[model samples]
Target: MRIHQLSSAIANQIAAGEVIERPASVVKELLENSLDAGADAISIEIGYGGLNQIKISDNGHGIIAEDLPLAVAAHATSKITTLDDLYAINSMGFRGEALASIASVAKVTISSKTAHQEHAMMLQVQNGQHVLSPCARTIGTTIDVVDLFFNAPVRKRFLKNEKLEFQAIELVIKRFALSAPHINLIVKHNGKLVLSLPAAIHEQAKRDRMAKIFGSSFIKDAIYLDVERGAMRLYGWISGPNYQRSQNDRQWVYINQRMIKDKLINHALKQTYDGMLYPGRFPACLLYFTINTAEVDVNVHPTKHEVRFQQPRLVHDFFTSQLSAALQSDGQNNTEQTLQDDSSGVTSSFNSKLYDVAGEAINMAYSFESTNKTSDVGRPYRFLEESDERYESNFYQNKLELAEPLTSQASYVAPLRPLGSAQAKKNLYSDIDECSWVALNNQYSLVFIEQQPYIVDVLVLQQKWLLEQLQQASTPLESRPLLVPVRYSLSLKLKERIEELQHYIEQLGIRSEWSIKEDKLLIRSIPIYVPYLDLRLFLEAVADLQCIQISSLLELMSQMQRFDPKLLAIEERMALNQFLLKVQNQKSQFHGVFKALSADDCRMLLHV
Candidate 1:
């Protein structure tokens, strides 16, 4: 056999395999073409999850009768002409391969009537042949792709079930609808109306679209942002810390109006949201980033769902700063709003009754089992994927665990106790011989005891240390003034209840200021260890003091330990190392918490 150039039909089929992945891919390509043609109102009709037929009608600039043949030919495109055009792509698609590639795998009929033409022309193509004829239609375009993947058996077999496939297709349409809110979109599946979004040109109408898609609760919790710097502009709605989801399904972001999954963007957003949210929770966000087209290259990936920024670090920093400032400002505004209605506080009799509570201890052995978030920037639809693949990041790769005490913040004097030299280990733990600690996957720690190795949970150790520290309750907790006073809504009743528990609250190390005229409590001071504590939960602990145990107040301090042990930042790791060392110094006495493992168990752990 000799090497030879592949025929046009074979070449296009191979390209189709890359771009046209499933029914959704076909829908995406056709929609892009429609949008690129300046469509204002688009209609999509699907049958059998696009396996049987797909009809896309758009009122945009249409093809002329003379160019109907070339329109379906491979490499024929009006989007780009030279090498410079590829470098600065502004359209959703540039390569003319979409229509050609689509025709290679499906029966395609394209009908169009340009504004300059009195009559429309329709072209029907199948199996590398085409027929052109006069068509009666408006000044727009209609593409009907039938029998998708008809020429590609292997690709057809790789598709998911009909319902799942339709879901993926619907997701694509929704994305387009969001990016082009000014466009009117109507979709139908199996002759039943599925989605209909009328053109939204006003702010109120756009918000209506958002509420329809993400729910009214999302609108209630989300914050609108609009900021710009030089050639870059960032705008959209991001849910506050209180509104969160267990998964990233609601996170949608676009670059220059193109929806993409960029790791840089994800990392920046996650970094901006750090400390505000627990690692496991994801907030709902719909963001759009505007950058000069020439500054970002969108031709890097085959799917066009990724881009390369000319100045990635600069873009990342911009995203972080803007998000952080907006969120903080929003927090302050909500905290200071006035409430004028007057109401009496809780009854004095109710406040005078002191109750004792007995509850289970907080032993979070499984809290640190998995990293909360990944920087993969995954696809919008994961159910269509063959398997779930994880790509761990190197963003925190070079960072090492901290072995020193934490540095204090501005205008604060809280003692940061550092572990002493190896000689002073006697005070922390009564050990018989040499000992050391090794962290395992941020979940467990392996400590050596009398030359024997055992595993211990990191959270369990932290809790044990905290409980031991609280035994001598007379020692006052180190309190630090907050940079900005945190406000918690103080209802007339809750405020009275909190004032009654003033002694207990002070004992737990939270200081606040109460304004007689204002219905809010300003948290001016907090415990030195944790920078952020949930105000809602703290208030709950005060209100439910009769039911919540004595340890409940200190249990809220668990926010301090919410960090990835293995991927800790340089400074933070140093602080954690200091914390862990104390736990290590006293681990010898945490009897049942440490487990001895056989040689096989150790080997299995290492392999895992």
Candidate 2:
């Protein structure tokens, strides 16, 4: 094949492959451009999951008559002109690919008129081909896109189902709405008003807007956040410590007016609420970050949903510190208010302040009836034989009788103390000499240096184990056979990397090939040592491993060789079974496990 300059239409179609991935992508780009243009009110209409048609009208600064034609032209944009402009790009569509790319895949008609002009101009284009010149129109810009992917049949087939696609589009609109509470956004799906967020300027108004979109209950459980670092500012409402959802859908983040999925920031938030929130639950947050445009790069991805920050560590620290401070402040305020309210009441009691903090409310009517009963008070206390031989024999017989039942129960019972008596506190600190290693619950090897629960990071340990197992399993000396061959769909870059390192993989006696039919890399042979292993998960781990440097890979490989597959499997199974048993025991014995950790334990667990 000879290299030749592609036509404008072909070039735009190629760009469309990246920019116009789906209906939602188109909506995101258009909405972002409207926001960049300072639109205070935006309205969106979609039909047939935005495939049949999509119309977006924004009351922003409309384009001039002459500029209307250039708006849909390739590489033509008002966002950037100079070389330095790329470094400090504040606008969302700096590349100017969205309009042209969208036009290449769909029929687009854009009508606009400046606020100062009496009439607007409309231009129509079909699949990168101009059909009509600028014509007169009403005020504001109304962009109508119809027959999306009409020119690209292959791309159209890749779209999801109608409901799923609509959901994706709705997600984009909600994120944008949250990002710009001052902008009124109305979305109509198939002529039905799916969402409507009126313009809100006050913090309460914004919270109400969010409640209308997410849920009304979110307002009561949300925490207001506002903090600023050197050059970065963070302001938003986050869900309280106990307010959590099952997924990350509610976690909205925006950097400099552009919505993004930043891993560092997400991790920082998780660290802030680590022990405060339940496991497997995510916090609902509407975080907005403002920083120098030059400090971050948004052009790294075609979708512009991901960004690279210059000072990721600083940003992470700032997020954790600010979020933690806000939550702590709320806790202190509530505590102080409770104390003040209690002090205002006149109650005759010994150690009034001490009792106030830990007082338990009693029903006055019930207490008066219970006070008349004195005969049953003595019946509450009972005495048993205290002779050593008799007590020891009873204890032994009870242990023998209860062994099977206790094992089935899997419940932990604390030793009881006499009522109204001074209880001795157990020493939490451990002596170094007495810190003998013991297998804990048949999983972790506990060596209590100072009575703190300690274990290696689970993810790191799992990865290390996997690496060692793969190495040994690849050896031809093993006789195990896999029941199923795992196939992995990888990016072109990752596929190339695998092929480059095929020699190393073959040395482990594992067979692999590129499956052109599925557009993936297929693992035809597995390591004999790990026949039960899930190959898909292993391949994903491999891809993650490839993301790091060669030195890190070598280090990982070395560390992985030390892992024992049998021991790993045993530990995993024991941990899982223990968890199941604990859940069952809790269901039978207790209402729920609301174990409160001591201040020292909290500090240790949170690494505070």
Candidate 3:
């Protein structure tokens, strides 16, 4: 075949194949164009699922009569003028391909009257030809398309059922209605009104619009999240932990007012709900993230449904941190968090060194140990019994009821006593040893200091100890290069996603290179704290995880410490006992978990 350039009509039809896949695509393109034209009031009329006709009327600044011919010309866009403009696109219809593409595949008529014009002008195009005349009566524009895909029989045959296409179009309209809550959108099907949304300029009106699209129940059970980090801001509503979805259909994420399907975003948000949700369930969220346009590339996808961030790692971490904090705090933060920044606060990075909280796991030597059961040691509050699984749940409730609050003021009456719920000078842990304590219900242990009684929650102490360990290290996890870079391949979609996550993966201590030409992955380094990647399956598993941190040795110790005394390995019990001895006299440290036995508490213990 000889090399040749395709005709203008043929080239437009090709672009149509990429941009207009279904009735919904056409609606999306036209509606976005109207919005870009600064339309606040738009009306859409669909017939036969857009196969018979699609008429869109928008009260936006209309095209000048002289530009009618250029308006339908492919590649002639008003949104961008130079390379720099392309990089920082602020308008939605920048490609200038919608009118041309729609014209090539269907019969299109554009009618408009500029505000200064004496009369309206109309342009009609059919089968690669155009005609212009004077008509119409509004200061806005209306675009009418008929017999869509009439010139492309193959594309017509591939369309979905009319009912399904209409549903898809309805969904596109709903997206606009939600994203542009301040716009008035009216829709009609076969000349019957099906939907109407008035402009929502007030907070209450916006909430009402949300109820119509996502259901009132979602709003009732959702928490509002408005947080910011430098120039980036994330604000929206997320359903409470108890309100979940069977599937992730309700997860709506918009970047700078444009809806998108993003893997990194979904993954990070899902991670926030890991333990809060049940298996096979997903959380409902309506979130919007706004960032500088220059920091992201939106032209990578044909439909502009995905974006590439300049610093993906920073963006991902920012999302995870802000969302996690809001979700954890349940929109009412009781724990004040200090956000530490290394530079201008426009960015964030995750402390993957969290794995170092369990350091021995980096060596792949951490494993669960078993032991015999210990006898029930308390009334109404049973310690963890290997055979009695029901007690742990109830015991946690008891701990909350009995544990000392952190804000209790110290009493001058007992200068030697630690900050606790109550001071009992008669009992103190100042001279107690590990062997002198009795394992009590939940994680509490009864100990004797200076021959007096003092009670402490051992589990709480272990957690505090682990935190101190991490603080001492005060460094990021180490990454060790592999002797030979691991190589592999995956589906093209997964390949592209992982490549996009290269910087993020590196922040998790993975150094990798992805080759699009061959669809291969080359991994040169892995986080040192991740213990057992000495095998191929482990390597593959780690790569597929995208990012994972090392486990802290203390996590293992905490679990074992909870085992019934008899079920615990002798060495584990000895370790716990030894730790109890260390805290025997740490009066200032147990402000929240230590309780000196009152005369009444002692009397009850003796059953007197």
Candidate 4:
């Protein structure tokens, strides 16, 4: 076949293939035209998912009676005249191909009456054929596109199901609704009103409109953004970390009030939300960007869904810094509030007699240690020395085993049993309400409540305590300087990502630096509590942070060591007992991450 110039009707049908992909495309083009014509309010009606009939009425500046024919003509636009105008175009519908291409494939009837005109003029076109006539009165434009894709049978075959098409149409309407909150929009599908958004002229009204569209739950977790850099201004609502969705469909990005899907902007957004969200989850956001008309090319795509930026790098950096700052600021607020609440909880806990005794005992023990600092003994010192009369039971001597010391230079030392003298035990158990506890096999505690013994997993209490400590820590955990720095080799990409997140990583108590000569990452410090953490697993988990949180790493650190009662120091065991006592008194049972028997369970055991 030889190359030849396509006929006028074939050319238009080809253009329609690009612009009119579905009913949503038609809605988008018509809405843009309405918005470009300065419509404050618009109404849309759809039938059979816009395949049978689609009517749009808008109170905008109507086309001139003479220009009505030109409106349906190819390449004729009131928005732009020359190629130079494309560089600085502002109107949403500049190519003017929408009406002409749509008219070529569908039955189009455009009726309008300018404010000065007494009667409206109606222009009807069917497959490039036209008819002009005087019609009833109307102050604005009313376009009825019936039997869409009537001439293009192949295109009609590609149309989606009615439900899917209607969903797409609603999605497009929602995009414009968010972009121009001041535009009152009413939408009907098969005579049932699906959406009716009033004009949002004020900030409160705009927020209300957003809540209506996105839901109140999203609004509760949304952070408002307004950032400007040079010719670029970014403003909108971004969902917080807690408001992530399973899909990216919830993300709405707009450039100069025109909804778009620019990969550059989306990549920047992903970078901002890298460590903030979980894996395979997307943040629900409505981001509006305003840049100089000359700085952006909105004609990059036929559907106007993509744009080319003059300085893509600069825009990307601006978005990253501004959005990061906003999220970080919100996080800091939450952290401070948490710290305050924890402080209040500590103060309240001091009012309890058992809690006060624990605090006093710990303080007195620390004071004793400060005075004994001059002693040169290498062995671990006991906070509470056992009396000579308190005999070490076979349970402690035969069954207990000491854990390996944390540091390489240290050697494991046998742990001393915490059993007190007869008098001390009597004093401790006197207020127990006919209950007694005996450490069972060093793994469980058999608590005899009202003469019935119930087994309890001590590890459950330990896990709960560890979680509470990790979650409510007012300051970062204590970190120890490494005697020899740990080195990790990495690919260039992973290295760059780590360097980008170096600041955040350091804040989490792991200090790392890139070795210039060796070309490997050097870890200089680590949390003191988790001395045996697997550095490779920790770094990889941190690098691939989408699946978990930074705090989760700390939780992992705590979990690496199994719960062991014999390994705990005397003070720690006492503290565990105090915690369990509190739980029993408050709730009559301990309900930890692991299920432990309750007081009711203890009673049920006696019955059985």
Candidate 5:
């Protein structure tokens, strides 16, 4: 194939494969452009899964007549020019590939008019070619994209169902809306208006806007955060400890007024929360960070959603501090009091505000009047006192209801009976004394030799089990002792200990020596029983064991050789079963005792 320059139309279509993969991608790109153009109010309309038709209208500073054609051309952007501009990029769509990419695979009509212009100009682009000139139109910009991916049959087939595609579009709109709380946004899917928000300026307004977009429940549990450290500024609302979602869809982070899915910030937020929250559950947050533009590179990606920060650690630390402070302040407040106070008057008042003007006007009129005043004069004073007394009684009753129960059925208790009990007295008089091992009511194991039961500690039994297993297994040690004497180097301290215990090691067929050059102790051989022992651990275990004086080395040998694998396994299983049974018995005992107490109390009340 001969090398030749590719045409602009072909190049744009190829770029569309990357920049405009689906309807959501197109929505994201257009929304970003609207935000960059200072759009305070934006509306999106989609039909037939954004394949048959899609329209995005923005009340922003519209493009001029000369810029209309360039806007649909690849690599044509007014956001940046010089090399230095790459580092200081503050616009959301600096690459200017969105329009060109969308125009390549769809029929696009951009009707735009600047605030200074008397009439708007419209340009129609089909299959990466301008089919119509700029015509007169209304103010602002209205972009209508129809038959998306019509030129590419393969891409069209990959498009999802209308409902799913509409959801994707909604997701993109949500990101933009979260990033720009001051912007009013409206979204329509198949002629149905799914979202509409008035312009939000104040914090409460922004919260209300978010509630309308997300849910009122989110706003209820949100914590406001605003803090600055050195060159970094952090501000936003985050969900409280008690508020969490199954996934991270609710988490939104924007850097330099551009929405980004950065993992560093997410990790920092999670770290602040620690393990107090459940795994896979994410805290809802809308975090915004502002840093010096020159200190960050925004040209790293085509979508401008990823950035390279000069000091990521600083950003992480700032977020961690702010989030921690917000959570700590929330913890200090009495949530019950706050919730009660809010529910009594504030929440009711706020809920009424969501209604129409007529309802709100009626609410206002009733809200200001003294609710305590009664129409009837004679019984008014008596009624007021009675109402006050009833309210006080109900408050106390509520407090009592909320209090923790003193005696719960779940508490654990021991099952053993006292010696003076009737059952113990009966066992004492029986032939249990002659039995070598008597099971205490089929519960406990008691060994008898001279008319007395010998009780063994459970922990001691566990240790014996481990020792038995070690003895029966092929020893996991390296060095084996030989009959012939072998010299080895050793440290001064080790040499002294070895000399003192030479007879002891010789009996086991091992030898050692002190080497001044190496300044260490070296062993020639180990016991035959533990031929593959770790030299260090074996020596340490021996030293510690030897510290306790015994009558004879033969006794020590017998003690070490007592471990047997089969017996050990049996012992361990038996011990585990015993422990499990003990725990169950104790739990049952607790329940029985609690039930008896409750019964006794009921009987006493009946007698009274």
Candidate 6:
């Protein structure tokens, strides 16, 4: 074949392949254009999951009659003019490929009436051909797209069922709605009103809008965060430890009013909840990050769902520090607040911060930033303290519940005197010896270092040990073949999912073979770590392939730790001592494990 320039239609269809993935993609682009046009009120109408027709009406400044033709022309945009504008882009539709691409694959009609125009001018593009007509309308714009993927039939096959596609479209709309609470937006699916959100005029109105979308439970269980570091500000509601999602679907992150799914932000948020949550569980977050436009690049991705920060390290560290500070002081300094009724008639309020079993607001945020104040990154993190209220009066009334029982030896250790819970003190033991250890109540161990005693909760120690073992395991853990292979009958869908995750499952030391004839899966072996757990129940619980990872192993170990350590033989006790010694040598506080008491704390607990 001779090399020649492709036709305009072919070129546009190629661009559409990248910019348009599903009905949600089209909705995103059109909504972005509406937002860029300064539309405060927008309405969306979709038919048959947006495959048959999609209409978006926005009450914004309409385009001039002359610019109507140029609007559908590729590479023609009013957003940016030069290369520098690309780096610090403020508008959402800067690339200008959306209209042209949508026109190439579907029949599109855009009608507009500017303040200067006497009548509305309509432009239609069908099969890559253009037609213009004059009509009467309001002083705004309405774009109607019909027969999506009519030119490119192959793209139509990629679409899911109408129910699933509409779900995706609804999710996109909700994201935009949350990102811009000032906008009055309504969505209709097949003529049925799915969403009707009025413009949020006050703080109460904004809270009402969020409650309508995310539900009242979220507001009740979430921690309100407002913190700033340098030029960046992170503010939003992060669900407390009491509330968690099995998947990260509820996480909404917006940077400068633009919804994004940047991996850096995701990782940073997940890192914040390091020890508080186990694997496969996600905290519901609605975070908004505001940074100077020049400090971040939004043009990195075509969909603008991802961005590259100029100083990613600084941005990440800042998020970690600010969120950590918020989580730390959340329990002690929380103030009660109520939400006023909105026009929607739904009102909800939060009276108290979510507290953990320890009676402290669960601090999921772990500080990962460097500790050195003078060595580069900046100052050490300091939490905001409430001076108005003193520490909780019931601090010593609550007992620290140990998740596991301690190993007891009457001959080798001294008796433990009852002590109340000590006020939280930073850092752990500076000096210690094995001779100063004493087991207390078969729940915790008291260790004296430098003539000061510190409490070690056995449950915390067991959980930490189990988590480390699972994470450090060499992949493809040692497996033991079963004497009689276990068989499980499963649905076709479940069988397919198991087949898909066969590779990961094997890495955890479980081997399986499919028996299509019997509609069953034959398990050949089991991982040595999870021998006690019911294999069938475990397999069913880890149905999601994403859960079949180190997290799953950790979950299994946590379950195993529930069995008493008192059952172990004397030989086992010797081995356990070596393990405990290793833990003592390595600073426990540094790893989110147990923290030892300072000398001052020891005296306070003893009433010295």
Considering every candidate listed, which one attains the maximal TM-score? 1
lDDT of 3 at 449: 49
Candidates' TM-scores?
0.62, 0.59, 0.56, 0.59, 0.57, 0.61
Q: 362-447, model 4: which lDDT tens digit per residue?
A: 12111111111112111111111111122222211121112221232111110112224556545544536544556655456776
lDDT of 3 by residue, 1-608 (tens): 99999999889999999888887898999999888888899999999998898999998988899999888999888899999998888888788888898999999999987889999999999987889999967888999999999989999999998898999999999988888898999999999999999999999999989888887556765778898888899999987664555468789998989988888898888887764543345788999999999988899877898889899989899888887887766634311211222122422221111111112111111221111011121111111111111211222222212112111111111111122322321123222342466776545677664466777665566545433433333234335565455455444444565566555556545577865664456666654332222222223223344334434322321222222322333333444444555665676766765677879997897995
By summed lDDT, which 10 consecutive residues of candidate 5 come out lowest?
377-386
Off-target runs (Cα >4 Å) in candidate 3 are 331-608
State, as a TM-score between 0 and 1, how close model 3 is to the true structure.
Answer: 0.56
Alpha-carbon local distance difference test for all models = 0.68, 0.61, 0.65, 0.68, 0.59, 0.67
Candidate 5 displacement at residue 226 in angstroms: 0.8
lDDT of 1 by residue, 459-478 (tens): 55554544454443443465
Instruction: Write one digit per residue (lDDT tens) for candidate 6, span 1-608.
Output: 99999998899999999898888899999999999988899999999999998999998889888999899989999999999998888888899899999999999999998888999999999986789999878988999999999877789998998999999999999999998888999899999998899999899999989887876656765688887777788899987653545578889989988999889988888888874443456778889999988999988877888899999999988877877777766633431111122223332221212232244432221111111111111111111111212122111122211122211210111101111123311111211233255666433566554454556555456555555655665777655565444555565556777788788778877788977775556666655443233343345445644545667655554433322233332322333343456676577353544456786786787995
Q: Which portions of model 6 miss their true places by more than 4 Å?
A: 334-608
Model 2 C-alpha lDDT per residue in residues 1-608, reported as the tens digit of each score: 99999999999999988888999999999998888788899999999899898899998898887787789988899999999998898887889889999998899999888878767778888745565455676566889999999978899999998898999999888888887889998899999998888899997898778776666445654678888878899998887654555467778888998889988888998898774532345777888999999999888988988899888898889899998888887777755654564466421111101011123221111000111111111111111211111112221111111111111111111101101112211111112232323443322343332343333223233343344334433233222222333345454555676787776555544577877876655554543332223232233234545355433443333222222222333224333223323333343332332122356776896985
RMSD of each: 16.0, 20.1, 21.5, 23.2, 30.4, 15.6
How should the candidates be ordered by TM-score, best one leading? 1, 6, 2, 4, 5, 3
lDDT score for residue 346 of model 2: 21
Error of 6 at 186 (Å): 1.2
Segments of candidate 4 deviating more than 4 angstroms: 346-608
Name model 2 segments beyond 4 Å from true: 116-118, 133-136, 334-608
**Candidate 1: RMSD over Cα atoms?**
16.0
lDDT per residue (tens digit) for residues 78-190 in model 5:
89998778768777878878899899999999999997877778899885557546566556788999999989999889888888887888788887887888888888888
